[model samples]
Target: MDGDFWAPPPDVSPPVPGVSEGYPGVSQVMSHGYFQHGGVTFPGLLYSPRSLEAAREFPVEDDDVFNVTYQKSGTVWMLEILSLIRQDGDPRWCRSVPNWDRGPWLETLLGLRRARANARPRIISSHLPVHMFPKSFFGSKAKVIYTVRDPKDVLVSLFHFARIFRPYRDPGSLGDFMDKFLQGDVPFGSWFQHVRGWLQLRGRENFFWISYEELQQDLRGSVQRLCSFLCHPLSPAALDAVVTNASFAAMSHNPMSNFSLSPGFILDQNRGPFLRKGISGDWRNHLSPEQSRRFDLVYRERMEGPPKNPSGDTKIPPGPPKNPSGVPKSGEDPQGTPKNGGDP
Candidate 1:
């Protein structure tokens, strides 16, 4: 979270010869799934056997709360919000520790013992899919908050994130990245698969879903709802503090919340801030019209056929494309893929 989860410390493994100073084979590491652990394969540059083994044995307390999402989908934002709630709006205390350390990434293995040794109500984060979690976690009473964003925006964000990391190459253009994203060639695998796997568990008593668009549209309201779900309802002033502290401007400027102060997490701060442009529909700025149309088609196909509700009705229905300001009404495309058009 705070530090580079992908870049293990020198003690984990010696730097590969002829590669980057810390990590080796920048392009090759991400282009293929070369690291295997616990009978699963992951992107080599981002994961290691030691970390995965720790993930396999990671303990999940009854009150443990996990903020799970694919990379760049408001993870830090959620971390800040959850931190504020847990700290009762004590900005000073919240700022005392880095957000990543407050809610350590479950898969990184780095600082995990510190996270466990910390206090009760541990807030953990992970980009791992449902199946990758430790076997005990599934049966535990731990709560999980799954965050999702529009696939298009996710691709754009991931593209920019790759550019900032030393282990990833230029990643070509937005089109190339979009193709990799669609084919599940990038880290954490397919966005569709990740969302779908979590959606399947949507009905679980301990599971909750939060859309990035929903957070954008109503941060305060989302925070309240999350608080209620976590059983940590806040007062008016506390809510305001959480909203203010979690804002893009506040987080971007605050090194404690943002990863800016964390070296190795971001390769070059001059290039861009880690909390860059926290908004919806940013895909419109980066993706071409044809690319958008192609992506829409793939999204519709992958998201077709909704999961069922208890009453036998479709949990989600086909609907029109979402406007930039609105959450996607449904993952399905009711009228089929739209023609090459402007941002939705």
Candidate 2:
């Protein structure tokens, strides 16, 4: 396994270094099993050894559309947008099922089954890095839309999110959380590595990149571009509907879009909303100047592939070739492998 794929936090002592098979000491904070695989530890609540194994072998379809992101980087928002486009701007159909059901996480234990049972041309989502996806994914014509947010903002949003779990207690001060985040101690591992890994595959025919900042700043344009990439272009009126339906305010209130309604599944409703303050740069309110400077130094050193833009414009150049048909071409499996799938 590549070193970049492993995420071992410095503060939390992992089990004996050589013990690679069982769950590590359970995290008191989240009350979830923490397991180590290939020397990398991840929360068992979302990923288990079985699920990981399943994901590595998961079958992928040519029409499969994956909305990939690190947690809290507008996964739900992109999901809603894709759902609407798939439904041809029919909000009723999009809301007919829970958002989770519409676009299930691909790495969770049951994610693959749920995604497979859904209507043809599934819109699946995952937090797994590019390399972590099943080998079939790389060879298939499946489309992947990876979303990224400024790490500073991701840290702040994740900090508040962790506090919501009863077992997690308060996340201490922002400074403490910032330190852990900078060190890749948080859930999904190093933000730098995650982004860099995916960014490295930017020019692939089936890969598309979008930034949360860009989506927030120009949702209509972003949605239009996204729809085109998915080969599900919409009319001006339909595009308007998608933008309206996917707005933060609308989704925050919708039970389907907000995880708060799920109760024990993920959110502790009493804590707060999952769609908390969707804007970028909110990190300024929490991270001190010194903390920000330190994070910047590390980010510059680690985040090497994509160029950073203040306005969040990380759009790839247009006119990349598209898969003629979702079907297997040559030397590809008729039915791609299935993988364990889920979000952080």
Candidate 3:
């Protein structure tokens, strides 16, 4: 189970002498569940050094649509919209297949295999940082949809998420999680680093940058824009269908979309639903005044955001930075032929 993977922060340091399976509600994550690569922390239960390395080398067909996001940053929601768009606003697929399987992840071995074997116009998802993404992506015409959310909201969502997601070590307390989050100790590493690194690349023709607030405020408009970017425009009727079905209230009731299909060991449904409140600004309710002040201070200090961009969930600056930084520098692509699949 340990053939090279990202080492989650909870157990980065040596574990206590006698704590079996880690002390409950403590910060010690099991060794088997993590792996480290290029100083980034990934939940390793589904990943491996070989797997991640392979994904980096995977052949990225021009038809690939990567939904890249940090956790709880509208990852699932965006998938839902994309899935509906792929289906031309049909709910049949959305109601049958789980979103993860429908839009597989690239960091995990399973996702890698599924993707390699998948047909064209595949919807690939990932939480990987830019420097570690698939190498072939740079040379290919694969379109990427990157979503950002208010860090405060992300913090609140991830805190509750940790409670229900078994792969994550207990977040301890809100204060503890906040300390680790600000310090880049959570899964997928520093929010500041992840966002800053990707922000530098928002200008690319193939990349579409969107904020969670934009989605919340105008889902229909956002979906329309995504549809346009995908070059798969939908009719007014079809577009309306997509907006209605992808709504939080609509998706919450859909067994396939809400991740209700997840097994008990993977997700403790009794503790909470996976698609818990799908709104923005919920952080205000969870963060205390002092905590908010502290978070704002850290966010402002860490993020060298575009000028005049509000600190948290910094909006994408009007235009791409002078020299946008995206796609990690690497050697040439492998000789393997990328699999082909038609539009979904």
All models, RMSD in angstroms: 11.7, 11.7, 12.5
lDDT tens readout by residue for model 3, 58-139: 8899999999988888998899999999999998999988887889999888888888877788999998876667767777
**Which residue segments of model 3 deviate by more than 4 Å?**
1-32, 305-344
TM per prediction: 0.79, 0.78, 0.79
Cα lDDT tens digits, model 1, 8-73, are 001011111111112221222223446543323365665676776677578789899888898888
The collision pairs in model 3 are 4-49, 5-35, 5-36, 6-35, 6-36, 7-35, 7-36, 120-341
Cα-based lDDT for every prediction: 0.66, 0.66, 0.70
Ranking by TM-score: 3, 1, 2
The numbered model that scores best in lDDT is 3
What lDDT is reached at residue 222 by model 3?
78
Give the range where candidate 1 is weakest over 10 consecutive residues by summed lDDT. 1-10
What tens-digit string does per-residue lDDT give for candidate 2 at 143-184? 888887777778888898887754343568878887878777
Residue 80 of model 2 has an lDDT of 91
